[model samples]
Target: MGLLGFFTRKPHERAGFELYSAAVGAARRPGFFAGLGVPDTLDGRFDLVSLHVALLIRRLRRDAAAEGPKLAQAVFDAMFADMDVNLREMGVGDLVVGKRVKRMWEAFHGRAAAYEAAIDAGDLAALEAALTRNIWRGEVVPEGAAARLASYAQALAERLAPQAMADFTRGRARFDVEVPA
Candidate 1:
């Protein structure tokens, strides 16, 4: 590759990382665990991140612009790459890293599919059920927790869908800052 190519910023790459960062930011909102009763464990955190990323990807897929698909794929790739780094940092051995990453990918795909279906159906009940099953890991959730999270996800999706692709590519995509009480 030429020096110019090396130095030039790739729009999709920037957008992908931006989206992932946004997802992480949303997931880290303390209210999700404190007010909403989402477990504060590693798996719980992963579930939140997965949910946010799935919502972003869903919006990207629905976009009809020429760059949508490419950007979406880049975002997905960025997510897995982050997951790989995280696993390694947690002391996962090289020999099993590939297997662990594969499992994470499978989990992501499953969550994405379920989220897409619920969002498409436009049913809060379906969204709540999906969150309860996946994020809460099938345990009995505190009253209204799933419903609150479902509302948050729907609000986030609505906010993301109307954003211009250029904003995302420029690393200016925004998620709602207010966490549900």
Candidate 2:
């Protein structure tokens, strides 16, 4: 059986979908929110990462019950760690994506050991707010980060927003075109 067996998706299909979710989820984490220089704390309207995670978990629970629990947990695990690395690597600056593949690995898994799990619902919120404020902004990201992010977003839309994804994948999505120099 393959990874998709859990979702009744074909093996290859499931692989893409899983990567899509994982990447999308990571992109929405507080780290990502901070990347755009957004404030850490607010009226809870713009914390896209937390909002999406909550909604995703809720919807998954409603849709899949038992399986949703496992999936949600896995996503939470992966996102929290991925977000951390993305932030940490940015701190060193002068990044260029292609060069830090190995560093990305150590930061993703190893750095996770340094932080504690969310102790409570409120604690999670506070933690996210603090980290978002301290880490995402005021740091420089390596080259290709934007394209990497775009790829994840594209994959996510492909999986969840099939019609939109299809349009974008086919080069029909709306965007401002830049003329070459």
Candidate 3:
């Protein structure tokens, strides 16, 4: 390591940021709003983003790569960093930014915990319940909407499970990249 190392981010940090950007892209897919009826409001968008990011972290943790945990932590940090930037961009006052970010951080963790637990258990019904609660705040979704979203999440997780760690370390988001390397 050298002084330049001090000035620039290490590869893992960049990879994490890239991966988080990918999650955001997945969350923004219009099907969620138009078909699935995701609220399209700020809170709704935030929940979707959190769901995708948690999925990535969960997938990363399942792999045996030596970098997996580091990458997962980096992904988590990148997400909150993004939240902080978004808050500032939205003109949130500096004095309350930390508090607001904290609340969001807690919210993400709670949702992530529910998501991870349900997925790990292979309990689609549990996942559906959690998704319904988080995405719609227990309001009735169009019939079968939660189930459909749960299926989508499960499919994405499976799609990601066998992905090469190389794509991730290279800062090529495995889930969202449009071109082959």
Candidate 4:
């Protein structure tokens, strides 16, 4: 088994694994990677990428516990941040990057649609299934796509990990205290 195998081996881990994998695969497309300014040595950063993925999972899990539409929005936001870094670092065209961003947007909307369907049908199992599927299975991007996405995710994860870890360790922070009347 390989490093990716660790991600694929556990069904429970598949959702988060595939989420980052899809972004990586998307960024690795010929025009995509070329447009993004990705170099040829992304594989060198695999370990760091793994750390980002772990952080992404942690963030997602934390956000999911919150009420309202924020959870989905946070997921979408994270995806965008990862995509932005890829495009910005690679010096890709705005048009190309925008197209890629739309693709990501659609993916999140699709996820929401699935979640809504499950909810409308009152099938919690379906929601769980949709949320857990390995969406990136059999997806192939250009040679370095996975690495690019992983690295991007890692960088973003690194940015968030300090705060994210604090949240994990200290539990959720309170923004407002109730006043006794």
Candidate 5:
């Protein structure tokens, strides 16, 4: 840690925060809840954001560069910070906020692991099941909603997988818009 390191902004850190913001923005897209039938509640929204963040982290981890891990950590940090702020806004007490944040971290990790495994296996059905359980909370969802959400996830992953690391580092990463069928 040198004086310059402290003074100058790191590229990975900046990119990670930008990526986090992008994920949150994507989750807030009304199409998912309105058109796709994802629940609009807090848990539903968190699951969607977690899914987006997991995808980004997965891509970053696949990069061979040393900056990949740093950027991933930064993204994770940004997510928890956002969660903490959200919890506070929802009237969570300061004393119990730590416990609630810990639980949220656990939920995020569990969802990420499940999603990664399903994606790695190349099983769309598994991914759909995971989404149903996590996003829909094991409840019966509207017909085709789970499948449509699964398709969106797959499409989004495909779009993200080919993005240039240079573009990502420059905070120019793009996600596909949900086109009406």
Candidate 6:
């Protein structure tokens, strides 16, 4: 409510950006593009980021601490803000930026829902299907590519589950799960 409030951010806001940073880094790891077969194009990269962010959000929402939901929302806001900046930087006309971001948000939402349901069901096939549909764009993927990505995601979730809520709130995200080559 003060003038400085405009200049400074809340702790959760910083934590959310940190978490988003981690997700972007994880998505850029070469293992995904070379080993697991995600395409290296812009859309492919965006999908990978979306997938990682979705996983992180899912983890946060399940946190035992009440701060989980608030942090999760922060992460979501940070994502769209970054996307908006990215679009403008890419020379997208301002008139279309909102529409583009809206479409991206819809894509993110669908991917998140599908991944969540599959993970909750413990169904690797369903996960693979979702990955193939979204990441691979329904094309015939390289052999076992989608399956490998699904395995990696499941393992990453397992790794994320044990991290303390405090680590996230302190902007110390840990996303070093081994990607199955």
Top model number, lDDT: 6
lDDT of each: 0.87, 0.38, 0.86, 0.42, 0.84, 0.91
The TM-scores of all predictions, comma-separated, are 0.92, 0.31, 0.91, 0.32, 0.90, 0.96
Candidate 4 local lDDT, 111-132, one digit each (tens)? 5556446544656556445433
| Residue-level lDDT tens digits of model 3 in 17-118 | 989998998888888887888888999999999998999999888779989888989999999999999999999999999999999999999999999999
**Model 6 global lDDT (CA atoms, 0 to 1):** 0.91
Model 2: weakest 10-residue lDDT segment is: 172-181
Best by TM-score: 6
Worst ten-residue run, lDDT, model 6?
171-180
Clashing pairs in 2: 95-142
Model 1: worst 10 consecutive residues (lDDT sum): 169-178
lDDT of 5 by residue, 108-175 (tens): 99999988888888888989899999999976688888888877887788778888778777655576
Instruction: Kindly provide the TM-score of model 3 when superposed on the true structure, using C-alpha atoms.
Output: 0.91
Output the lDDT of residue 30, model 3: 83
Residue pairs with backbone overlap in model 4: 35-92, 36-90, 37-90
RMSD of each: 2.1, 13.2, 3.9, 18.3, 2.3, 1.2
lDDT of 1: 0.87
Sorted on lDDT, best first, the list reads: 6, 1, 3, 5, 4, 2
Off by over 4 Å in 3: 1-6, 176-181
**lDDT tens readout by residue for model 2, 5-97:** 776732223322353354354434554444444344421222334433433433343433344445545545544555456656667444544
